[model samples]
Target: MPQKKLMLLGGLRYLLPVIEEAHKLGVYVITADYLPDNIAHKYSDEYCNVSIIDKDAVLRAARELKIDGILSHAVDPGVTAAAYVAEKMGLPFQCSYEAACILQDKSLFRKFLSEHGFNCPKAKGYTNVEDALEDVGFFNWPVIVKPVDSAGSKGVTKVTDKADLKSAIETALSASITKNCIIEDFLDKVGAQSSADIFTVDGKLVYPAYSDQLFDKNAANPYTPAIEIWPASMEQKFQDDLTAQLQRLFTLLGVKSGIYNVESRVCSDGKAYIMEVSPRGGGNRIAELQDMATGQSLIVGEIKKALGMPMDDITAPQYDGVWCNFILHSSEEGSLVSIEIDPEFKSKYVRDVGLIVKPGDHITPFKGANNSLGTLFLRFETREELDAAISNPDSWVHIKLK
Candidate 1:
């Protein structure tokens, strides 16, 4: 039999392992990105200079190359384009273009959640700044303003006052692909479920992943997720209940066979409200963490699912490990003086710790995930150790950015 040809939408940094795994399984890998310098572009059997969001161009390449399958994991924006090409090419990809459109649009997604009786924050979409400003007072104070179709928290803000509302709306709308954004009622008690990647091929009711988020109150000077730890610290029964509920929600939404990075927040009364669901792997190295926690690679599992292969051969482990991630965000903008991380601590359940900024590089306080300098990955035997290391950054190492 011929080796399967897998055409990946983006390049290596993340999708590399996905490509490597597929290649290891005797599948030919073809990668494409607008940037030829992308890390993954160099490693593929064939490379193309193409925009991932440009559906026609990607489809043309896939068809011309006679690709057996097309996939993307890290980039959420590329998922729809990949799905479009796969569906048009008569491949086994999940998610319809309409579904992708809806999921990509935060406003539309919130509407779907509301219609389905899921716990979702009150939100409304607006086409321009004026419309958003006029409708601002409809929701309570401390509204969340974010772009309708953007990721990595590129243009997200929370406004508790009228003066900041207009600016926040304009900022969010400026970053929107649709020239629109959503204004949501902010929940004071917030928590997010970073897991929701693994699921049964057809049922949509199977467990994917369930992770707890960690925030750095000092990074942005307010509060945002500086890290995320998975297999959540929640009670076993709570995890099971959440899984069952989320599975049912997915089944209701007709989702199947793909990895999803879902975000949700817990209300003051302990009700978990659905935030947004990306039909792709979680960002910030969470997928790798999920692998360590479950002993099953979520990306590989997704590939098996997309390929329609028998997945029962691989089983998720019961003994979960602690997976931790920390984002490096500067509190001020200046030249990178130095990062003093002890090399000896590399093996101390610290899976990976990388500082993307080097000496002489300019660093700025992070406004969002895109602005984050870098990330650190750690695997701990106990949660206590992980917490201690995260809480005491000085103990871990002094990150000195001038």
Candidate 2:
């Protein structure tokens, strides 16, 4: 049999594990993006220089390379392109191109949820600032203004007053690839918001996982997640209810087998809302953390599915212990610095430390997930320990800037 060829869109470090898993399965991996210096390109078997957001360009490259499969794992900008390419080439993908488009755009997804009777915020999408400014009265006070197509909270803003809506809309539009933005009712969550990866097989959701997403209130963008703890503190009843609703949403969209990044929340209104669902691995190595906590490899499953190969039976995760992925970030922009972790904490709870920037490298304030310095994988014997440590992370984890 010929060696299978898999084309991956984007060159972020998140693709490293996907490349490793594909290699383990004896598949040829091609990493494609406009950046030749991306770290993932160094690890991939081959690199193709093409803008992943340009679906037609990617399709031309894929055809020239004679690729067998394609994926846009952990890369939000390429999900639609991957789906488009897959649909055009008859390759495996999580959903149809239309579905990917709807899910990738917050405004479209919100409309879908509303149309289908899923709990969602009152939201509206606008391509022009004039239209959005005109519709400010459509949303309640303290509404969230964000890009319809951006992720990692790059351009998310909370507007408590009408005077600030215009600036927020401009920020969101600047971050948006399509020059579009959404203004939505801010759903006051009861507790920590949930962001994690879930898996589906043949359009049936078989594995569901949730995490307590934390944020640094002092960060430049407070909406960006700073820490994610598995076994979400959300009540089991709510999780079950959300799962059922999620399955129904997928069924309505005709979603197929693949890993999906889902962001949900239990709002103060005594209702659960599914905020976002994208047909790709989430940034922040969410799938990787899920594997560490549950001993199941969504990475392998995703690769196999992308290549039209059989996947392992993916069941609901059974977490053995409390796990947390602490995103390493600096609060200010500066030159080379060192990250410090208390010796006792490092020895006891810290399982792995993945640093993206080295000492002396220029660092910037934590504006988005892309500005993060690294990640710390941690395991705790109890949730109490996890909570105490995370509550006072400065006591143990410190990033010294010069």
Candidate 3:
């Protein structure tokens, strides 16, 4: 049999490990995107210059390359395109083409959840600002306005007053490639929101792990997650309930054999609502952190399934210790000089501390996952210690810039 050929979308750093794993399995890898300068292209077996946002363009490139499988990880631009190509060419896929559309578009996803009896907030999509402004009164105060198709909090704004609604809509529409925006009620969170990674084999959920989302309220964009702790502080019963809800969702959508990074929240009403069900691996290295905490290979499983290989039973580990992954970023825009981590943080439990920007490199303030300078992965002996350190991170962690 000939080697399996995989065409990956976007050249982000997260694809680095996926490409390496494919190579180890003797699979041919082709990384495609308009930017050939992306780091992942340097490591891929081959690189194709095509814009991932243009579905037809990507499909054409995949056909010319004779790709056996098409998939994307940790990138939002290729989710729809991946499903489109796989469905058109008769390849194994995570979900149907129609379901992919619903998941990729925030407005469509909200409507789908509501129609399916999921506890989703009432939301609406718009193409123009005037229509959105006219219907602003439909929702109560404090709503979230965001691009219908973008991710990583790129164009998300929390609108409390009517005066800010129009500007928020314009911002969201500008971020959107389709010039679409969605508005929905912003739930009063019970505590921290949770983002987790779950995998399904043939539509059966096999492994599940949840993490408590940490936020930097002072960051440029306050909504973006700053730090995340594995084995979320949520009650076991609640976690189990969320897992069941996810199982129902994938089963309803006929999702099979792929990874999902799900965002959910227990609102002030004490009801769990599924916030977002991202069909691809999340951008913040959530899958990698999930693997480390749960002792399962989320990334490897995704790779195997994408190549149409057998999937072993991966169990969700009952984490005995806490793991933390900090989505490191700056709060100011300037050329980075260096990062200074205090000796207190250089513990033996520190797994890795990666900084993407070197001296003299321009670093943007935290707005989205794309603006992440790097990640800091560490393990703690106890949740108490983890809580203490994160509660007062300013005293130890410092970023130096000129």
Relative to the true structure, how large is the alpha-carbon lDDT of every model? 0.73, 0.94, 0.86
Sort by TM-score, best first: what order? 2, 3, 1
TM-score of each model, in listed order: 0.91, 0.99, 0.97
Q: Which candidate leads the pack in lDDT?
A: 2
Error of 1 at 170 (Å): 1.4
| lDDT of residue 118 for candidate 2 | 90
- Report the lDDT tens digits of candidate 3 across residue range 1-402: 998999999998889878987898899999999999999999998999998988899888989988888888988889999999999888877898899999999999999889889888879999999999889779977899999988889999999889989899999999998999999998999878998778888888877767899889999999999988887888878788888888888888988888887889888877888898877888778877777776778888888888888866777656758999988888999988888778857765567876677889988899988899899887998989888888877766788776
Better candidate by TM-score, 2 or 3:
2
**How good is model 1 by TM-score?**
0.91
Report the C-alpha lDDT of model 1 over 212-301, residue by residue, as the tens digit.
Answer: 776666666344567787666655555565566677666766665767777765667677666777777766666766675676676777
**Ranking 2 against 3 by lDDT, winner:** 2
Task: Tell me the tens digit of each residue's lDDT in model 2 across 54-149.
Answer: 999999999999999999999999999999999999999999999999999999999999998999889999988899888877878789999999
Task: Score candidate 1 by lDDT.
Answer: 0.73
